[model samples]
Target: MSSETTAASMSTTTASQNPADPVLAGLKTQEAHPVSKKLRYADIGINLSDPVFRGNYHGKQSHEDDFTHVLRRALEAGCEKLMVTGSDLKQSTYAVQIAKDHPGLCYATVGVHPCSAKQFDSYRGGPSALLSAIGELAKRSKASGHTVAFGEIGLDYDRLFLTPKDQQLKYFEAQLDLAVEIQLPLFLHSRAASEDFERLVSARLPQLPKKGLVHSFTGSVEEMKRIVEMGLDVGVNGCSMKTEENIEVVRQIPLDRLQIETDGPWCEMRPSHASAKFLKDAPPLPKAVKKERFSPGFMVKGRNESATIPHVAYAIAKIKDISVEEVCEATWNNSIKMFGLGEVSK
Candidate 1:
C-alpha cells in the first residue's frame, strides 16, 4: 500500500477507537503544522533490529510487534529514509535483510559495536574469521544496495564494564581496517574516548573517500571541532541535546557537516532536557502509552521510534536559530551525500 494510504488507514483506525487518542491528536496537529508535508528527513542511525520494536523490553514481551506501525508513523512524520544500525555480526545480517525487505525506504549498516568487541573472540572461527564474515556481509549487501555504511563501531570508554578497553580498542581498529577495505562510509560511535577515537579514525581517513559519521555526538566544542577537522560528519540525536553544553555544541556544529538520527529505543528526548524548551514550537509527537496498554498506532512510552525524528530537527533548528525547513533540508542532503542512499523524493 502507498505511504499516504497506510497513514490514512492507521489514522482512521485510531480515530474510530478513541476521539481523544494521542495518535489522532498528533495527526491533527501534523495537518495543522504541515511540517511533514513540507520537509523530508533521513534518520542516519536507528536500531530497528533492536527487540524493543518487537515489544520485547528488558527480555519480556509486553505487546505484539509494531515494527510495521513504527515505519508507517515515521513516514507519516516525514522521516522517509532510515538507516538501521548493525552493532554485531548477527544484527548486521538482520539489518541487511531488513533493508532488502523495505528497499528504498530503509538501509543498513554492518559492524561490531565496540561494547560487543568481545564477541569477536568467541565467534565460531575466532576474530579473524569474524572480521572476514563481516567483510563478506558488507560486500554482498552493498552489491545489492541493502547496505550503505560500515559501523556501530568505535570506542566507548565509559562502558568499559561491558567490554574492556583493550578489547574495544583492538576490535575497533580491526573494524576500521574492514571499513577501509569495504570502501563504505562509516557510522561510528564514541563515548568519553575522544583522544583515541580521533587518532584512529584520522589515521584511516585518507583511505576512506566517503569518510563517515560520529553519531550520537555529545562531546565538547573542541571535540566536535576536532571531529569535523578530521573530515567526518557528526550525527545528532536526543542524547546529543540533553544538556546545556550539548545544546551549545550542537549550535556551533557547521550545518553542512551535520546529520540527524533518532537512535531509537534509546536517546529519547525527555521533558527535563535542555532541548525540551526549544521544542515548544516544534511538531507535536504521537501520544505514547505504557507498554501494557500499547495500542496499534500509539507509541510505547519510553521507547523512541524514528517517528520522533522530526522533533530532533526542530530542536536543532531552534538551538541554531535557523528555520526548521533549512535544518531538515540540509540534514536530508548531508545524510544522503555521506551514505550514498540515493535520491529520496520529498
Candidate 2:
C-alpha cells in the first residue's frame, strides 16, 4: 500500500477502538470537554521540534503528522499555546519555522543550550560571530512571527557531558547579555549549577527584563527563594516534581510565580512522586496513545505529552492547598504575562 494509504489505515485502526474500553476512556473525557469550557493553557517550554519527539526514535511513524495529532490532543486537554525551545542555531531556526506555520498556537525561543556551548568556538567566526548570528535571528523572528523569548540558554553542571563548565559559563553570559540587549523575556535552564546560576542571574538582574522563567526547576527551597527574589518565575514539570524533596520545593513556589510545562517525551512524572498521585484516581490513557506508545517510562508506559498537563495541575492543586481551577488560572495567567501571549490574545 502507499504511505498515505498506510497512514490512514493506522489512524483509523487506532480511532476505531471501543470508547468504553478502559484505555480509550480518558481520551473520550478529554475530547468530550466542552468547547466553551475549554480553559486555555500555555506550555511555556516544550521541545516540539525535537526529532526524538517527532517520531525519529520510533520506527516508521510519521512525526510530522504526529505533531498535528499531539496539538489536537493538547487543545482538548486545554493547552492552546506552546513555546517550542531551540537548543542551538539549527534547532532555533526549525523552531521559528514551526511557529510560523502554526501562528498563534506555537511560539519559539532562539538560543544555544549550555550543553551545546562547546560548538560555539567552531562556528564560522567563533563565539562573537555566533552571538551576532543569534541576535540577527532573534530580530528576524520577532519581526516576522511568534518569537516570544530568548533562550534555552544557561549552565548545566549535572552533565557537562559535552560542554565544559568554563565554556558553558562563557556562552551562558553571552546569551544573558543578548536577552538584555534584545529586551525579550528569557527561557532558561539550570541544573546542578545552582550556585553559579544564582550568582550570574543576580548580577544581571538590574538590567535584565522583568520576565524570566527558570524552566524545569529541580532545586532547593533556598534556591527557589533566591530565584523568586530575583523576580524570575519558576517553571515546574515532571522533572521538578520527581522527588518528595522537589515536591516540597514546589510547594514553596508562590502561585503567582509558578508555571507548568510537560518538557515532554522526557520528564514523564514517576508514580512515586506527589505530582502523579492523581493518576491513581484519574482516567486511563487514551487507547490511541497506547497503540502508538507515545508516553515514556515503563511505569507510566508512555512519554510525557502536553495532554497530560491536567495531571500536573491536579498535583499542584493537591500540594498548594488550592483548587485545580485556581492553579490552572494562575499558571495560565502567569504564562500569558511572562511569555506575552496575552498581547495577541483574541
Compared with the true structure, the alpha-carbon lDDT of candidate 1 equals 0.86
Clashing pairs in 1: none
Q: Model 1, 80: alpha-carbon shift in Å?
A: 0.6
Cα error of candidate 1 at position 333, Å: 0.7
By TM-score, the best candidate is 1
lDDT of each: 0.86, 0.75
RMSD of 1: 6.4
User: Model 2 segments beyond 4 Å from truth?
Assistant: 1-31, 34-38, 58-64, 280-285, 288-301, 342-346
What are the C-alpha RMSDs, in order, of all predicted structures? Answer: 6.4, 6.6
Q: How many backbone clashes does candidate 2 have?
A: 4
Q: How close is candidate 2 to the true structure, as a TM-score?
A: 0.84
Query: Tens-digit lDDT track for model 1 on 187-279?
Result: 999999999999999999999997999999999999999999999999999999999999999999999999999999899999999999999
TM-score for candidate 1, please give it: 0.90
